[model samples]
Target: MTPRRVTVVGAGVIGLSVAHELARAGDRVTVVADRTAADSVSAVAAAVWFPYRAGASPSMPRWLARSLIRFAELAEDPGTGVDLREGTVVERAPGADRSWTAAVPAAREALPAELPPGALSGVRATVPVITGSQYLPWLAARCAALGVGFSPRTVPAVDELAGSADLVVVAAGLRSGELLDDDSLFPVRGQVVRVANPGITDWLTDDEHPEGLTYVVARRADVVCGGVAEVGSWELAVDPAVEASILARTAALVPALAGQPVLSRAVGLRPGRESIRLEHVPGDAVPVIACYGHGGAGVTLSWGCAEAVADLAGAGLAGAG
Candidate 1:
């Protein structure tokens, strides 16, 4: 059998995550991207293990469970350079969203009243949240160490991947509009204000359990931050009004964040689709797999999705090709 060298498009979290998995499997990997992976939307995502909020999907909870288990494995390996930590996710108004808590029974726990006014119900556990800026650079470096190449050139179409790589994996995130030719794909704009603080401890999540879902997360670097999910928004430019709204919602959930010196503000798009695109297409005889439309869940779902992609690619290479 001839050795298969794989070309992965889009170095975002999902693409890189797939590359990492494949590299571990001893496949030759090359990552092609126009912009640096760290600058992509995957970097902008405030990674959380929280999967779809129940009613959000039928199989999401199951997929999340599988991904989370994988996340812990990858995060525990310092070689992967993941920023995994323990966090307490609270569902407002307590008794609400029990079904979601039940989905991940490992999360539910008792919280003291002093924590928040509407602290209805909660769950506490350690999970991995990849700092995109840190993790992507680490992944790229590791892939390079394994003899994988990084091409700064942009692939405009699946055919363009021919001869560039033996096998093609399209992980372009949202930019797949050109290659995949689906302009219906758009960005779900979000703003996150990271604040450096020594006081804000504990990884927290504001899942709309009871009252409403609004929350903040603490970075390994001690930046307690908050974010927003504004859909169909193309504006990468952070609006003053949206920034204020994000800060206001954050403060409302965690008072300690109020009056604290803000460190910085960032905006990134969460590529969305009615359904996630993860399918194999033929690219001029080179195998092509498209893995996009992660929406806001890419951070949480990347691990599992990568595994799924690798498994599919392995089948494709095993004959019947």
Candidate 2:
């Protein structure tokens, strides 16, 4: 197959994934973004693999399963910054979203001992927990090794790349809507506090916490304590009250995180939409593939969505030919 020139916008997990896949498929790929992967919001993600706030779609299950398989495979190599860790999802209400468990064979009902206080039920499963600090850089390096070139710049619109590349992928995360003129995209604000690990390895999530969504994800370097999802919030300032509340809630859930010296705190705006947009855009000057609006599942759904994007890009190129 002749290599088609492809430009992917954004350097977050989704964009880098698409660039990697396309380059691997013999496409001359270039990633154009305003920021590097380490500087993007994906770097700030707690990055535990579950379909948290994922779009409701029939394809969600396939994406989840494919991503799970890929992450498990990557976990075999330490350089990938992927870890398959056992964890518990605390359910405080009846009939919470257990849809993710279907993709996980080892997922099962947690024993009473596993349940945190004030939890109605829980699911114990081994899922991929990504250390973004390592993973993002690793992914970008992998893309580079595959001959995927990167252009660091602010792209005002996808049309700007029409003359330069044969195909364009819009994976600009929060800024995707502005580029595509699709107002459906919005920011779901998330804040997390990183702390020194206290010899804890297992992870825990309590989305049903009455105060806010709480989770403790222990990676190789630090334990990520997070967070709250605020819809339509664009504030980047770290809130002291929110940090205190997060520490209190996470410590109450795990207890081990108590008094752990703070490493750092970060706030990120997850690109949220009614459903993820991962399809071809018809009637454009350049054949455009839309693959943004992954919300918090950008890391969770990265590999799977990238494969889908590559397939769509292939089809588009074939048709163009």
Candidate 3:
């Protein structure tokens, strides 16, 4: 196949992953973004492998399964910042959708004693936890080594790259809709606190927490405590009350977080939509592929979506021939 010039918009996990795959498939890929990985919303993610707020879709199972396999392989590389960790998901309701367990065979019903106070049941599983502080840089470095070029700039429209590239990938996350002139996209605001990890290695999540979404993800350097999933919220500033509530709830769940010194606070606007957008849109000066609206599952679904994007791009290349 003849190599095609591809311009990928956005440098978050989705875009970077897409670039890596496309470049590996012999496409000359250039990544254009307004923010680097460290500044992108992906940086604020608690980054555990589980899907959150991504909604139920038939494709989710395949995407999740593919991502798990890739992450498990990446975990072997210490620089990748991906780790296989044992964790628990506390449920407040009985017979909750354990369908996600299909992707993680190790997942099993938690024992009665394993349920935290006020929890009806739980699931224990071994999953990948990514430390974005380290993982993003590692991903970018890998992409760079693959000869993917980086352009630090904002693209106002997908057509802007028509003259320079044969294809444009709109993986711009929350701002993607604006570039495509589509309004179906919105943000699900998430707030999180990064604190010193006090030797705790396991992770826990209680999405049904009465106070709101609460999760504690421990990494090599720090533990990521989060968060609130406020739909339709665009606020980016850190809310003092929200931070306090997150610390209190997470500490109550693990106890070890009671007095940990806070290292930082972050807020990310997760790109939310009724469903994820990962299809090719023709009729543009340059053929455009839409690949955003992943919501909070951007990282969880990244590899699977990237592989799919590369397939779409390759199909387009073949058609042009």
Best by lDDT: 3
Please report, in order, the local distance difference test score of every candidate based on alpha carbons.
0.71, 0.91, 0.92
Model 2 lDDT per residue over 3-83, tens place: 789999999999999999999999999999989988899999998998888788778988999999999999999998999
Candidate 3, residues 171-205: lDDT per residue as tens digits? 99999988888899989999999999999888999
C-alpha positional error of residue 262 in candidate 3 after TM-score superposition, expressed in Å: 0.5
- Per-residue lDDT for 1-321 in model 1, tens only? 445789898888888888887887778888888877777877776666665321144545555676777767777776654655667766555355544344355554656753566666667766677666677787778778877778888786788668757778888987876786677577777777777665654667775524233557776664546566667878878777766766677777667777777777888887877777777865355768878787878877777778888888888877645
Off by over 4 Å in 3: none
Show the colliding residue pairs in model 2. Answer: none
Candidate 2 segments exceeding 4 Å error: 319-321
Candidate with the larger lDDT of 1 and 3: 3
Backbone clash total, candidate 2: 0
How well does candidate 3 match the true structure in TM-score terms?
0.98
Higher-TM-score candidate of 1 and 3? 3
**Poorest 10 consecutive residues by lDDT, candidate 1:** 51-60
